[model samples]
Every structure is written in structure tokens, then in C-alpha cells.
Target: MSDEGEMTGGEDRPLDWANEPHMSSVDTIMWRGDTDRRMRGTICMLEIYDCSPDWDRLVAAHEWGSRMAPRFRQRVVDSPLGAGTPSWAVDPDFDLHYHLRRIKLGGDGSMRELLVTCEQLAMTALDAARPPWEGTLIEGLPDGKAAYFLKAHHALTDGLGAIIGLAQLHSPTREHNPGKPQPPSPDPVNIGPLDLIGRQIGDEIGRIPHRVDLALKGVRALTNPRKALSSALRYGRSVPRVAGLVSPPGSPLLAHRSLSWRFSAFEVPFTDLKAAATAVNASINDIYLAGLIGGFRIYHEKMGSPVDTIPVAIPISVRRPEDPAGGNRIAVGRLAGPVGIADPFERVLTIREQVRLARHEPAVDIFNTLGSVMAWLPGTMLMQFSGAASQNDLQASNVPGIPWDTYVAGAKVERMFPFGPLPGCAMMATMITHNGTACLGINSDGAAVTDLELFAECLIAGFGEVLALAADDGVEPGVLRRVE
Candidate 1:
């Protein structure tokens, strides 16, 4: 699903009209990660209340918003000879209606039905020929309510970038008015295979000087015995740390995976979570990881195979202030969750300490640096590397979101659930805070995570255990709420 926002510095300024934007190295990796059966896409589900939005107004709003973000009207143009990274070219045949769809729920229009519909949409891969996004308006909910499901390719944006794009389509108040229609999008240029290869070769040749300069600097450093010794010492010390960044030994039960996916969602009160974190002297992220550990432990025990620990990949956002708003700037850090620890408080404390030390390790910097290089590799090699990187049991991420209540085209948005890609992992759990509540969306590989319903119940029970820990700190248990 996609939202509307411009690249940094593109707002209010006229389009270059001379050159198309180049996909970043990180984005290129995401693009290559997409396969025919398994598409790496991010789905955002927003439940709106009161009434359905006017179709015409919503379309116009999207049009206006897309004008601000030209990437919405562009498609990735890969180099014909695999000479360089892909480029973003304007899609001359871009159709607003094709990307924006409307569907009506049958019968009572229960939330379960809505989610099922969303699951189908999520499973269907986005068309690579056009822009990599589609927004669906789901109508016919109880009490005149409706929902919007926005699906965007992972190559287009990360979690934070998705939030920023969505903000452009919403308003602080219902009285806001959408402005006039914008000008037409630019036409795409047609470049033949020979031209594409020439352009790519030229680009690579242009980098020769920079490469030689770096090589000379490296030679100079090696000539200095003291500097070379220091560098060798640093490398030797970081060898183990770099190895630790890869997946650790995990439960064999969740080792097998399939292309199929199952999405589960639940809500927890933010205040209760904050209290629990405070009681343990940890961050909200620590509490989140702790809860997952507890849940996984319970799940394994129920399956008659309790494990000691599980490795989880945590995405660390490395976005800088000057980075554009709608591209990826994230690195993965693997952590061994102490699920063997029976005490919830003790588990949280252990996780907090582990995360604190992991962040400071030189391995994380090395991992990020390698990630940039991996993006330029062949798609098959990158996929192999990604498969190895995602060998961990689960991936947990916490993306900060809009704090205030928001409205989309005059409809009140009650909840926002973010569904991240499973990415060969057993499960991908992501949480976002919206309007005083922590909304968690869990996307599990259906083949690996059998009995998703029971797993969801276990997650709720896990959070209950954490909230119980917070009770000693004077936080009321009643503040915690669960939605399955």
C-alpha cells in the first residue's frame, strides 16, 4: 500500500524534467528481493469510522498527493545488461483508477471478513510494470464505517517512510479542504537495450577515479606500520562480533518456511506498556522483545517442545536528517532472546542489557556497510545473502507513529495496523503507536507457524504477564486491552 509525499527538497519546487531519480542502493536490494511467488511488500490497514469517504474526493486527493511525490507515477527501469542499479522512470501509462480500487464487504461486514479480504490483497503481488503501490477502499462495515488498505513495495519505502507518506494524505481536522488538481505527469523516455547498456557502462567508468583514490589511501595506510597494526587489531577484535550479527542457532521447528502468509493483529494500551518498561528500567522496545520471548516460550511448550532461546532480527533505522522520506535506511541486528528465563521481569532486563551492548558493537556498523554493497550484487546472490540473514526465528520492529487522532478525507481513522514482510523468517511482528494504543501486527509464514489462532492467544497471555509485572509499580491492570 502507498501513501503520498514528496522526496526531501522536492516539495513546492518544480520537477527537474531533465533526469529521472535513481533508486538508492538499499532500495535496489529490496527491489531485487522480490520474487514471482513472494513479493516483499508492506501493507498498512487503517480502520476508518463514521462514514465512507466520497470516492471522487478521495481520488482527487490521491492525485494531488501523487503530484507532490512523483515516485508514485514512476516505475523501476532495470538496466538491460545488468550493468548497474535500476532507475526510476516516469510511467507514461500511469492510471490513478488502476492503482486506487474500491471493494464492498458482503453480509454483516465483520472485521474478520475485512481482514480476510485484506489478506487476499496482501498475498497478490503488486504489478511490477506499473508503479509499485495500490490503495483499496473497503466499504460496508457496521455503523457506516469503512477501511483503507494501502500496499506498497518494500523497495519504495520502509516503515517510517510509509508513515511519512500517509501523513500527507490525512489531515488534523475534518474541516480541511483539498486544493485544485495538479498538472499532468511527465512522459517516460524509451531507451533501447543497447542504449541502456552504454549508459550503465559509462556510469561505471565514471567511478574509476574515485575507486583509485580510495585504493591509494588504503596503500598509504598499509605502508605505515603503526596504522596498519592498529587496523589489523581492530579487524581481529571485530571478527567474532561480525559473526554474531548472523543468525544464531534457533529452534528447528520453525526452520521450514513457505510463500504462504497469515496475518494476526492485537492492540495493547500504551500506558500499560510504558509502565511495564518503567518497572523494568527498560525501553518500550525492550518490553516488546520480552513479550515476544514469553509468547514463543509458551507456544513451544504448548507444542511439547520448549526451547532455550531464539534468535530474532531487529531492524535498526539508520535514517539521517538529510535522507529522503520515502526510501529505506535500515540495518538488521540479530539478538538471542532469553526465552529460557521463566521470570518476565528477568527476561526483560536481560533483553535490555543485550540490546544495549549489541548497539555499541562494531559488528552493526560493519553489517550496515555490507548491506550497502550487497544491494549492487546480482539478484540471485543478494537473495542468497538475504535468505541467510533472515535465518533467525522472528523479526520485531517498533516504528513511532502519529500521536494524535487523524482523519482521512473527513473519515476518522480509529486504528492503524502495520504488516511487514516475513522475508523468509518464521514470523515478522511490527508495532506502531496510534492514539494512545500500541497496535501490533504479526505476519507469520503459514507453513512454519501452524495454529496461528493459538499463537495469537499466547501473545496476548504474554503481554498479560508483563502487565502483571507492572502492577507492582502501581499501574492498573485494567489499562491493558487486547484485540484479536
Candidate 2:
């Protein structure tokens, strides 16, 4: 078939040939209009990098998106789906421009203008008719570097999935193709309340036998009250230890969050942070938070508002092998990082211990389950309240990376930095390792972190100090260095 003919046929087909969970399950999970307005599924963030290609090249590169099937590539659309499915599902009627937008920000644009543009771009609502994904060719990056801002709903992909998608769109080595067949148009994605209810009914029916078995098992276990009590005690004991890492409400260190967002970025040589982790027997995440604690120390100290403690909420991934990879599969864990501890090693050690202990807490699962339950509320309600409550200080996430080579548009991805949302807090720091470099993306509240450049400088300095301490403790200087 001709290229246009193939594209036309693909767009007409129902996405049934692709993966279809019960339509109800998808409806429940997709981000709904209510949630979109309040919390808005605008959870994803993007960083524009300087590439050597012209505008036409970038647009042509994306045409590959429409040639694939829904299973291969589809955007999510919302319908009056029920609670069982996600609110976002594959959009069969995929329109190229709906996902790709062009914006020029030159005439008198400043750095602030770029940020405002990004935020506004973030706010531009996704078309419920097509899939919930977008790519904007962002020109006018400072220093003449053209950029692209690609965003998808949080319901579509998490950190890992986003990285993977970017990798697929790129190639390890450069090969300029004049043109390629377009990817298939996606199938229709819709979920209504009836779909949710039906899926729940099916789930209940399937679980009857297992639930019965679980009930009998529970009864037997309850008969052995001593064992159960012992297990409970063991679990309870693990909480207070990690309490420093995840302070519950009422902790003095939890800072106030505002409505605005601020952003800054820092690059730490992977070799350095890895050495620090080795010295302290901490993971890269532990050191990442340590660096954050160090930065917060500077931030609060400059404000003359330093506190002895601050609670950080760390989102922990809880996806099991059997779980689907697409949707949210993570949980949050609160830990108190020692901001007051002047000594870097002491702070790292404290974080290490608390994080270690937190692994055993039953409450961690309870909190995660609570988030899942809350996700079921009307999207509008969930967005409004979740943001309202979460506007507290600091969100730190550590997403694993592909240890091997990965590419985008055939450009060798020299680095990957992650920029997470800054809700109500003063700052959000995210770390991702790309080609062995630890790229840190920090989005600060413009008002709260007034001097974005200075904050970025502090992060750079603090990382050096932490790395020095790690090296002093006998960490090999070259262990974590990037291969590139």
C-alpha cells in the first residue's frame, strides 16, 4: 500500500488489535476532566536540548509516530469511563498537530519568559479527542540553542517509561533519514462508569476463589495470635528509625509550599556522587537527598530560616513483575534528612539508617494504598486537594537508568536531566544517570528561591563538598565516573 493509504487504514482500525485491559479498568485510571482542571494531568516535564537539526528534521522525525498500531504507539483519550480503568486511554483518532505544537519565544524573551512559556505550555490542556501527549518545538533557548518541550500526562508514563520512550525516538549513532513511513494512527481510547463497574464485577468474580482461600488462611493465622502480634511488633519497630527520613505531619522541619514554580539545574560528575555513596554505604538516592539537604541548608540559612529538621517525601516505586508498566506504579515514603546536621557524613549516615529502616514499615504500604484510593476520587477533587496538601517543601525522586547506550533522533544523548514539578514547596530535585553522569534538575518556586542562578551554584558547591567527604572516607575516585 502507498504511505498515505497505509496511514489512512491504520487510523480507521479500532485499537482492539492492541492491548485492551477491561475498558472499565482503563476508564478508572485515565485522568478525567475533573482531575485535569484541579490537579490537571500535567505531571510530566521536559528540558529542551540543543540539537544540530532544523525544524523540518524534528517534525519529520516524529512522523514515525503515526505508522504504528495502538499497541506499538497510541495516545490516551478520556471518556465517561468508570473507576476501574485509568482516566487516560489510547486515542484512536490521533491528529498529529494535537500532539505537536509550534511556539516562537524570541522578540523580547528572557529566561523568565522561557520558564513562563514552559509553564503555560504545561497548562495548555490536552485535547480529550486525541491522545494525551504533546511535543512543542521550543525555539529561543538561551545561547541560541533551539529546544523541544515534550510532555505527556503523568498517567501515561513515569520516569522510567519516559526515559524509555525518549530512547526509542532516538538512535545511538547519527543516521539522517530523509523520510520514514509514519507510525500507525492510534485506536480510540474511552472508558465510562459502566466500563469500570463491569471490570470490578469481573475482578470480583475472578477473585472469589482466591479471596475464599485468603479468608481461610487469615483465620488460621489469626488463631496463632502470638505469631501475628510478633510480626506486628517487628514491623512497628522499623518505623521510628526511618521517622527521621519521612516525618509524619507535625514535624518542625516541614516547610511551607507556595503556588508558583521555580527551576534550576546542576550536573554532578557521576564519579563523584558514586564515590560518596560508596564511602557512606548509601545508594545514589541517599547521596542525592544528601546533596538536596545540603542545598536546603544553604537555602534556609540564606533566608535565616534554617530549621533543625525537614521532612522529605520520597516516592518509592512498588511495581511488581506482574504489574503493567504503563500506569503509576509507585508509592511515597517520608523521611527526615538531617538538614541541621552540619557535618555531611553524619547527614548521609542518618539518611542511610532511616531509609534502611523504612523498608520494613507496614505504614509505607498503607500510605501507598491510600494514594491509590485517593486516585479514585473525582479528578477535579483529587487535583485540587492533592496539590493543596502537597504544597509543602521538597520532592526528591531517583529513577533508574538504562546502563547501556540509548539515543534520541539518532543524536548521541550526551546527558539526561530530570525536572520534577515544584508544587507548594520551595524546591523539587530529581536525579537521573545518563551515560554515567548524574544530571540533577531542580525546579524551585520563583518567589521562594528568588535567585535561581545562585541556587544552582549552591547545588554545584554542595555536591563537591559531599563528594570530598565521600572521598575522604576511602571511596575510589573513579568508580562512579561516566564512561563517556
Candidate 3:
């Protein structure tokens, strides 16, 4: 597939730093959740390949792209007394080199060594005072191929939003210019603590009329006794269901979590996964989750500690067509991982049904409603709530990515892997489909998942089990088989 039609001369566009973006309520929760070491930060990696571009040209391209998106040079500023959600402000001492790092691997520079470096990068926390993002250009691959690792705060943007922002710095073809550069932005105004507090209080006061209107609506609803009673009963019934969904039975082995993390990456043919899903009459996400459950089962069995189910958190994107590109616009969907199901096909069916029911449950709506109210909460209170909410055995996400060949600094993007935040979860497995391939990035807690190599092998075997359903003939699917 070619992205020629989607190509635009975005490089020439000037950035408007004056129009700064603020963190949404959902984003604020994620930001505050960083207080806990177990759920510290999130990072995403994009791997590019082929001819290596000149160092000067690569740095120039990044600088030009940064001018197009002011957020690249901005940092979060909290409101006084937690009166409002955090706002984005220009970083006075912003330096491109600080965020854009260039490193060269020694010798042959195998993928293992590169991944080791990436693990180190992932473990290190981003400097809070600066913009919450960094890009590392790693050179010296075996075949002169290069890879770029871009890491950013989860609070800045969700998976889809991050991909959209990255697309601005890439091209449909190698011989094209990146985003246009604009004049340097002016320094942001320095506001005193009292002044900031006063402004936030005033902003809160301005919403009095709207609050009163809502109160009146509540009173009117109460006047309709029958309607109010029915609504109350519905809410009352949903409480237990939501509570049950939140705290499901999980494996004891994966219960304990720590701050240490390990990263793993693998690629599978998108066509085979799609075919497997079609054959089983399930969505791609269903198959993916089934594979994860299978892997978890295998890992536990190998350790002589198997469990029936595992709690998994799935983030559902709620971004609308008219919504802006960045910030968090998502809700969580909890699933009871069917680890006990031995048959891959049956596992997929079970997952599809569970997910269908989860979507229909009122808990999802309640979760989204609470997400919108998180901005009004005090920082500490918000952190406590977020920390409790993020407790799950595992998290799986399927983010659709660029479906056509893309270029970054004249190099073809070989693969795109996304590593999401652990968020107190034992493991986080995220998949993104790029140019007909599904790339999976699995991040496991080092303290909880002790045997990394065995866990990785289990995951691979689990994926193979599902892929086997794609073949009509009675032939077992082996490791690394060609899908097409």
C-alpha cells in the first residue's frame, strides 16, 4: 500500500505556540498516577530501517518537525490548589539535543543489544521539568539499517494520537521533505503562584451557572417520581455488576508487581491473524486476547502454578471525529482472561462473548463518566483513585497504525512497536498493525515475571496456536511459519 494520497506539505505550516493545549481529565489521572513507582511511566518505540540518513539532515528534520508541533517544546504546569487540570506551557530552556539523542551501537549491533539499550531507556524516568518526550536515533546495525526509538508520556497522547503526531515527521516516500518549520516561539509569560491560583478560582467560579443548571435538571427529574425511581433502580443494579467487573478472580502467581520492567518485541503476519479471526467469527482483538490468555496459561503451567482466569484491562478509545489529535480520550474495559480454556478456537469464542458483554455493561459508561470528572479532583485523591483503578493482571491493546510504507529521515519504517505503561499491572501487551504486519511489544514486570525467556517463548507458542486455525488442512502450525 502507498500513502501517496495521504501525503501533505505539512512542513511549511507554522506552529501556533500561543494556543497551548491543556491536559484532559483522563490525561490528568494518568499524569497523577505517576506518583506510584509501580506505575511510573509509559513509552512507545518506532523502528525504522534501510539507508541511514546524514546526521545533520536527521537533526534538521526533527527540528523542523518540532516547530510544527509546539507541544514538542512544551511542559506541563499544574494549577494552584488543584483548581484546574494541568496546562501546557512553553519550556523556557528547551534544547533539541536534550530530547533528541543520537547513539551508535558497538560492533555488529545485534537486535538483542539494541533491545537491551531500549530496556535501559524504558526503565529510566523522563525529567519532569522538561517536555515529557525523547527520541533516540540508534545507528550501527549489522546491515547499515537504523532504528529510531521515540518515547513519550502516556498523559500527552493515547496510542492513536501519538501515531498521528509521528506521521507529521514522516513521508510517504523517502525523497520528500518533513514538516515545515516556523519562526521561533516567544518565551511564555511567568505567572506568580497567587496569580495562578486566583485565575483558577475565577475559572471555577465561572462555571456556577452551568452547575446550577445541572442541579435544576436533577430537581426536575426528582419531580418526575416514576422516572427518578426507575433511574435509581437501574443505577443501584449496575453497582454490583461494575464492582464485580472491577475485581475479578486473577492468578495468584501474577499478583505481586514491582517497578522493574523488561521489554520484548515480535512480529506476526497480519493476514494470518485476520484469517484466524474470520474463521472463528471473532474480531482481531478477540484473537489477540485469546492468544494472550493461552500464553499466560502456558507460562503458569510451566511454572507448576496454573490458574483458571486472569484479570485483563483493555483501553477503549473514545476519540470522536471532531476531537483534537492529542490528549487522552479513552475508557477501560475489564475482561476475565479465560486461561482455563485449552482450545484456542474455543478461547477466542469465549473472549468474543465476554468482550461483547463488557461493552454493553453499564460499568464502561460509568468508568468513562468518572474519567471526565477526574480533572476536578484533588491531585492526591486523583492519584489514589487512578492507582486503584489500574490494578489488573495484564493489559492488552490493539492500535491501528499506518497501513502504507512510511519514511523517517529517508529510511523506510521496518516495524512499529508500542510499549504501554504497566500502570501497576503485571504485564502490558500492545499490538499495532503496520503495512500488513502486526507488531507486538510485550512489557513485563521484572519482579513478577522472573523467567523472561520462557515467558516470551510461551507467548510465541500461544500466537502460533491461534494462527493454526487459519489453515484448513490438518497440519500443525510451527514456529515462524510464513502466513501468506
lDDT of 1 by residue, 1-484 (tens): 2122222223354233213376666677778878424536555555555678777767866776666567788887887644256777778788998999999988668766777788788888889889898889999998888888888888887888777766654666654443323446556655566766676666668868977997898788887989888876876676454444444687877877888877777888888888888887889999888888898988888888788888887877888877767777786666887878878988888988888766665555554455545555777776776666566788898998778767766677788888888777789898999888888888888888898877877787777777777888877753334453
Deviating ranges (above 4 Å) for candidate 3: 1-20, 80-83, 106-108, 178-191, 206-210, 223-227, 236-245, 365-368, 371-373, 376-378, 472-484
> What would the TM-score be for candidate 2 when compared with the true structure?
0.78
Over 4 Å off, model 1: 1-20, 36-39, 176-199, 202-217, 220-246, 366-368, 371-373, 478-480
What lDDT does the true structure give each of the candidates? 0.73, 0.56, 0.74
Each candidate: RMSD: 3.6, 5.9, 3.6
Compared with the true structure, the alpha-carbon lDDT of candidate 1 equals 0.73
The model with the greatest lDDT is: 3
For model 2, the stretches where C-alpha displacement exceeds 4 angstroms are 1-41, 45-54, 66-82, 87-89, 107-116, 141-144, 177-186, 189-196, 232-256, 321-323, 367-391, 402-407, 410-412, 423-425, 447-454, 473-484
Total clashes in model 2, counting residue pairs 3 or more apart in sequence or in different chains: 58
lDDT of 3 by residue, 1-484 (tens): 1112133544444433224356666777777767776777666775857866667767876666666567877888776665366777778788988998888976558777777778788878888788899888889887888878888888888888777766655667776443334446546545556766675666668768977998898799998899989877877676445534356766778777887778888888787788787777789899889888888989999999988888887877878877788777776777788888889988989899888876766556564555545567776776676676666789899889888888766678888888887887899998989898888888888877889888888888887788788775443443432111
Task: Write candidate 2's Cα lDDT for 176-251 as tens digits.
Answer: 5334334345456566667656655566588689769967986887888999788678657644433232243422
lDDT of 3: 0.74
Model 1 scores a TM of 0.89
TM-score of each: 0.89, 0.78, 0.90
